[model samples]
Target: MNPSITGFDYQRVTVAEDVALNVAVGGSGSPIVLLHGFPQTHLMWRHVAADLAADHTVICPDLRGYGASDKPAGTVPDAYAKRTMAADIVALARELGHDRFALAGHDRGALVAIRAGLDHPGAVTHLASLDVLPTLDMWDVLHGVTAAVGFHLFLMAQPPGLPEELIGAAPDAFFGHFLDIWTRDPEAIPAEVRAAYLRACREAVPSIVADYRASAGVDVAHDRADRAAGNQLRMPVTVLQQDWGAALGFDAAGIWRAWAPDLEHRTVSCGHFMAEEAPAETVKALRDLLAR
Candidate 1:
């Protein structure tokens, strides 16, 4: 953790079916839960979580199957469903006395947050997604060479055995590749922090792959059903994404508008890991969104 980011007391709690999560809690005001994306943990939000903790009761949790959280033994399809993971977040918040709270997630965590917003709109006061589209939109928008950039999405989405085996065989390389590639300023993440992330991913390979696999299969079904039922995130929503569309070929705002009616969307120059890559900008966007 960075010395500059302080004031949080870290604790471990179990939510939903004995799933243990490591959470950092601090500050006081409206509750705000932060979720980390793939190849990272609650540590990814170390900088941003500390900032939010200054005004809000910030709760940053390592999503189930990642970080210090318990990785329950299960198959890829069963272990990584966003529905199940979203339940863990809801249960965690409720356990911590927050029936309704603001929620934000980056990368994989963003996908789970989206599910939580869609499935439990009454419980999410506000929602912010960092650098990701809904799983369905992601698959729907992929094209020729543009999609190649996210090859891991397809590879990890494969059935249990092969994907897990390959990742497990070379865990450091697999996880380190993203850590190295996703940041414009790699030195921003200290050696200890980078090692921690790599270790977590190395140990939780099956569950991680299952998560992506579920996004490709069952998770998409859930999102489509929510859309078919005319469900839009009723809460004020904000999205910060790298300019994938401009760089690739789709409209980022246009796609998000389809799901959130009251959305404030922006494109930043940072890489996929916006929170760490652009903490000041991320903090500003978060403050502005929560204020609205």
Candidate 2:
């Protein structure tokens, strides 16, 4: 049996013509969709979801091509594009009876949330992102030695064959590497939870690689177009990050301000997986965002 969010009702919500997302939904009164990051699943939001469920209907879904969700082969060129994935989330929420909802995402999930806010501004009431810059800003800022921290992005960005084969060869070490290094406190991710993440990622190697590959290609193009058109997130936005901008030599909040006019950006002391390592703070930040 796989690990899941306790007390949450689980179901498969068909979000596309062929893709149905495995979703865990709980609580009532208004909806807030939570999207998980790479190398993990909706279970990553177990702590925060439960806390938020007290007042808000919490919807956590394993994004398409991840976890228990359907992973249609990336036969279409834009199959794994953030725009497409964002549409999946929108459709999922509507299927679950939400026409509008607040949105929050971490890491890769944050990227998808950004796309959703831009593409469907009418649907997202508020937005929050944890630990990631927009795709275009991400590519622009990562250069020379600083880019080494995101080597996997470059590796997975390769043209299809080698990246998939190499990563598939030793999926655990490849997937577990982030699980080990990116986490500040090991205990934040319990043994069982870590194992589940590794298992899910191991099985979804090709699709996972395609996801990152799209970030490097189509995702960037989408963000670039949005920037050119001066498209910005109209909804109120909150961003929580680990002060990577200080080390990486960029103004994190400044960059975010360009895309989100009504923005609240704060730097946290915790690691990349802040929701697990610092759920209380994460929850408080979320609650505050909701109040606004």
Candidate 3:
């Protein structure tokens, strides 16, 4: 545990087969698990987690392939599927003795949270997604010049070796692009923290690519199946998005409502990285979700 970041007790725990996660736990109330996005670790929730910890027992862990978590080789295209990743969260919470808990995720993690709520509706008490739409909706909505904004999504969706090779060749520049572009305030992330995120991403290229590849493939199938089966998030869900649909050409809240029956969707001013860019609003949203 680094003393520089106070309030949380950090430890590494093996949560699955050959998967050990670096988890941070703090405060003393109901458990609220926070899942991080791509090119980022649990550290992305540093501010929000600390604030939530004051009233709720906050649990933040790097998703399977990112941060200090175990990066097992040969993760199949289906392995990075959101369903499997969501199961990991359930197992981690169970391992830590929480049978039911509030769940929140950002970006890639938000996709995982959606899967968890749908697959194991009984486990997740409340759900919060920051700055993302369902995988299928995201792909469906992309077209023309506006689609260029997420060029990396299409690039990283390619087959294993080539995409990994290209990204690995210049990892810092690749990861730094998002770190620099995704935030409304780049200064929100200190140099040391930014470098740390880039370094972690650089070392976990294969797993990271596999994660995105799943979204392009198996994850879409999973979402389609859920929709076919009339599955929706049973828990109360709160979504904070950047109003991409208005800027693009769809209804952001409308699309989210298709997946979540009980939804409270808000479009905020922050960039893609809302948790970091708008900590106070993010914290307040989480608190409201917890209350629901």
TM-score of 1: 0.96
Worst 10 residues of 3 by lDDT: 1-10
lDDT per residue (tens digit) for residues 133-223 in model 1: 9988999888888888899999987767899998899999999999888888887788988888888898889878877888889998998
lDDT of 3: 0.88
Best by lDDT: 2
Give the higher-TM-score candidate: 2 or 3: 2
A best-first ranking of the candidates according to their lDDT comes to: 2, 3, 1
lDDT of 3 at 135: 94
Better of 1 and 2 by lDDT: 2
Local accuracy by lDDT, each model: 0.87, 0.93, 0.88
Question: Model 2, 1-292: lDDT tens per residue?
Answer: 7888999999998999888999999999889999999788999999999999998999999999999999989766689999999999999999998999999999989999999999999999999999999999998999999999999999999997999899989999999999888998999999999999999998898899999999989998899899899999999999999978999999999999999999999899988999999999999998999889
Clashes of 3: 0
- Clashing residue pairs in candidate 2 are none
List, in order, the clash count of every candidate structure.
0, 0, 0
Write the number of the candidate with greater lDDT, choosing between 1 and 3.
3
Clashing residue pairs, backbone N/CA/C < 3 A, model 1: none
**Candidate 3 segments whose C-alpha is farther than 4 A from its true place:** 1-4
TM-score of each: 0.96, 0.99, 0.97
